[model samples]
Target: MAFRGSLFKFLVVITLYDAFLTVNSQAETTDPTKMTAAILVRVDQSGKGDYTKIQDAIDAVPSNNTELVFVLIKPGIYKEKVTVPADKPFITVSGTKVAETIITWNDSENIFECATFTVLASDFVARYLTIQNTYGNGAQAVALRVSGDRAAFIGCRIISYQDTLLDDTGRHYYSNCYIEGATDFICGNAASVFEKCHLHSVSEGAGAITAQRRESPAEDTGFTFLGCTITGVKTAVLGRPWGPYSRVVFAFSYISSAILPQGWDDWGDSSKQSTVYYGQYKCYGRGAITSKRVGWARSLTSQEASPFLTKDFIGAKDWIRPAPTSFRTASKPISHHSDGNN
Candidate 1:
């Protein structure tokens, strides 16, 4: 009996040692260029990963996936028209940094066809990347067009000249992002919150920051700017009514001198002046002049401005909870530029 026990113990020890060796080998042999994550696809321009193109990595994911599929993109300028299809949900595309990992194309005025990067999938999250339209200051070019629900863009730089960002539909969140354009740079009917972001106007002449298209007051579509900075070269207005009931609010934000004294426009429609809801609550800086603001524009009181200052406006708790909060409340109107990255 003692001899039999000794033999069994020796075999168990040998088995464990072999298993350790196998696991170690697998770890050591993992591709150095590949990033470790819940990554379903790895993209490397150097041809060391699963795919070389961002679109290929996106296509590799199965359709209608409920679980999040991460696409680890290496640092490089991917010059392709990348689109995240509507069928693919819970997709995350991430890179090392916004300046390092760029997805670019030059398409203009054709909406989706001209967009450099378009996301039609819901529950989409993108971080540490730059999306640009290189066509540069001619026609209506869109750098990034997002028509996805529960979509979040963090630490992203979207650069273009005209019609820069189409926040087309659904509820979206943009935090610590840099968006630049000349005309109607941020237009669409989406209920989006620009939190701690920098909005730049590159138009040599006058331009408009936003052109919200809310057809009805019942529709939950508007642009809310909280603790953000609006800086650019041209003299600009806050927004124009793309639709009759268009709504936009800039609360606790820094509006540079570039902003026109009129603050808001009626898009050349005199009747729209009575229907649009354009308001500013406790905003600051040289261009945040309220007394000279357009007669149609409103300076919201505390009670009227409360709802537009929180994540609950987008009902973010239902989908992506804990949207980035603002240190600058309506009462203080301070500039909170730091969202996370320092």
Candidate 2:
């Protein structure tokens, strides 16, 4: 009788232990955030990898993480609204290929709320991916919204019809990327630089490419496009003033005939013409006519254009090294124009 009671107790203990393990496994499966390990977070929707959702992998990362977290995303169309919060810095999100890996969402008109991929952390980097907003006929559909400091996007494609890419805040660097939009597509108050990029326009009617907002004279914010190609509908203007002190410069860029004769707009505010600084240099194309450009849109001098042509303009020289070698060379001479002397 003693041996029988002992055996029964052992069986009951084994059953309870097994039940505990089953419950714990279910919790880990449903809530990946329970794991706080700062390690490789691979995302695959095929159920062959660690996490099925990108956000779930990101949630697994510890808050205020200073270490480098590489989120390797596989080739798939992930229809998710991803956000790299401010607390999570030094995170690199990479994909197999730009065309193969796509993270997209449909957010329209609401610049503050609507972003397919929103980055609010510093020292963040993204490569070889396409961030897109599917809302084509919306008021202001933004594909990528970046407000992080020392952030960079490489070989990425940002697509939308209106307000496609928002460089909202901080210093950003975009290289060899493609941005497509109609009106104020690349608009923001951030001090950003675009190198060897392709800016495409798809306006059925009339549209403006950029809408930079530099509210205060003390605020050092502007849009600088270097070694880029601007192509789109044959009637799109270069940019307009979103703020009184808005600043935009296109240096060594190839402008398409699609650009309007008046390269810059005053946003129907006559006072902005005097305060806004819209300039261009060494831009060659049928549409890059200085004579037809607005009288207020002055041609930048070598001294003025040299500062913005370098990577230091976005403060990427110290942190972003070896990659942006295009900005390392000395600035080219500024072409003197009869009407450009300000």
Candidate 3:
């Protein structure tokens, strides 16, 4: 009996040692590259680039994964029709910077069916590129037609005569993006949060934003502008109701002088104003100081802004999406400054 007891103890010890070894082996063998969020694919104007055009590379990727595919395009003018399908989730199209990488094409209001870039995926990210439609803005020139959930645009520029950035579907986020247009140019049907982005008005007459055909107010199909800058000559307002139950909010924004005192235009339809939800929270600059804002416009208190302004509101739920293989650039260490802007 004593010998049997000793043998049992020996087996238990060996099992524990084997378990530890397996775990250590798995951990040690795991590749950091496989865990990368975005795989950088390059695009050059020269035919000698990795991918000749943008859409071809997007097609080459597999749809089974949500791992971000980062197209680190070199400086070039890529004029092509880009459509990001709904199946391709968590794809990131990046360029050097907005000033350098240019993606321009001409599609106008007359061409209602055509959109410069129609995004129909989730977590689609674009950074440091110019998306423009050179159709001269007569009727239906839509530079970017976004219809994705959790889409984020960082330090990008979108330009069109009208309908520059179309928020067609789902919850989206924009940070430091520049969208310029005229006459409902920024209108769309999506719940989007624009942060530190520029909303520029480029034309005269009936210059309004948002024609939101929200399915329901409870679904959050509206625009939330946070700490954005509004510039240009045409008088701007928060937005007009594109459909019944339209909603918009501007929090901590900087408005230019072009804004009207009444804030929003009736769009020749006073009836629609009854359903719209327009609000502003602590705006600065000339267009701000909303003493003359319309009665329909509401001012959000600090409490109301808390949830929307939180980190989770802007895709902080998970900063990184996982992929089988990827490259991760570590966050740079910041030098301590007294100003606390960092």
Candidate 4:
């Protein structure tokens, strides 16, 4: 009977694995955009791998159903406009090195269409490039806007004064990246996760995280910080409830002295303080003390620390791998930065 039970468990595991693969295979599937622009498109039609501009390669590939266009962006500062439409899926933009490749746009509050790169498509992946809205401490400037259904950022750096990451819709993932912002800069209403990344606050007075305008339970408009570091010079709360049902969690993360003892603010909306789900689990540091934490804030128990807080939490078990590497930590680590960047 023991042997029979063991065999049954093995079969069940196999069945579950197969089911997962099947589900992932169909999730947003792909689009059919190919990179037919040789291996390089030289300004003077020069030699291989030396394109005239990155935009040339981007323009060569046309968006279609099941688009799988891979553009190997060479190292250099690319200053231009990038618009990924809704039907363009599987647009894997990989740079040679994180430090070597940069895409910059200077659009301030007054500048219309102020987005460096806008992703309205689904299942798009970007790696090793620094995307910045070099609007210089202005308002309504967005560095990267993810309006797509499923988007991923790996080994990248996003810098801006305000609205750095505009998560307009769908599920998104950020791993091994650096994101710095001010005010309600990192605001959005999407199911998103920042895994093994760095979140920095630039201004003396600005919020680190924000879940703007999420009034629905079905829309997972929450930000899950998994094994990330939150540090700044000024006193920073975890976040204010931008919407009524706004949700966020810092699981297995590190908090610095820059955070206040209370850890959160009401944003002048007392009713939102009750409905929003804000919590922390297994975080350590000077600001980890929940003794003075807000009444609405939560410290999760071990049982509640399962899929919702683990690597599988926030749906990270979905499509987020490569570039930044997968989340392979058996347990959370203490927060300590070598460069004092944290």
Going through the candidates in the order shown, the clash numbers are 0, 1, 9, 9
TM-score for every candidate vs. truth?
A: 0.82, 0.82, 0.79, 0.77
Which candidate tops lDDT? 1
Q: 228-274, model 4: which lDDT tens digit per residue?
A: 98888686777887778878888888888877898888888898877
lDDT of 1 at 256: 93
Off by over 4 Å in 2: 1-39, 321-342
337 Cα displacement, candidate 4 (Å): 47
Question: 90 in model 2: Cα distance from truth in Å?
Answer: 0.5
Query: Tens digit of lDDT per residue, candidate 1, span 1-342?
Result: 677667755554454333222222332243312322343456889987667888877765545544445677899999999999998776778887789999998877576578898999987888888999989877889998899887889899999988899999999999999999989999999999999999998877778989998999899889999999998887888899888999999999999999988888777899999999999999999999898998999999999999999978888766663222222111111112222222
- Candidate 3's TM-score reads 0.79
lDDT of 3 by residue, 1-342 (tens): 677767755654454333222222332243322445455556666755556788866765545333446767888888898988887765788887678888888766443456777788776778798998888756788888887766778889988877778787777777788888887777777767888988888767547755656646576567888888888777666577767677777888888887777888666788767777777888898888778888777777888766666435545444433332545321221111223221
Q: Which stretches of candidate 4 lie over 4 Å from their true place?
A: 1-50, 65-67, 109-112, 311-318, 321-342
Write down the lDDT of every candidate, Cα atoms only.
Answer: 0.80, 0.79, 0.70, 0.69
What lDDT, from 0 to 1, does candidate 3 have?
0.70
Residue pair clashes in candidate 2: 109-140
Candidate 3 off by > 4 Å:
1-37, 109-112, 311-342
Q: Once model 4 is optimally superposed onto the true structure by TM-score, how far is the C-alpha of residue 108 displaced, in angstroms? A: 2.8
Higher-lDDT candidate among 2 and 3?
2
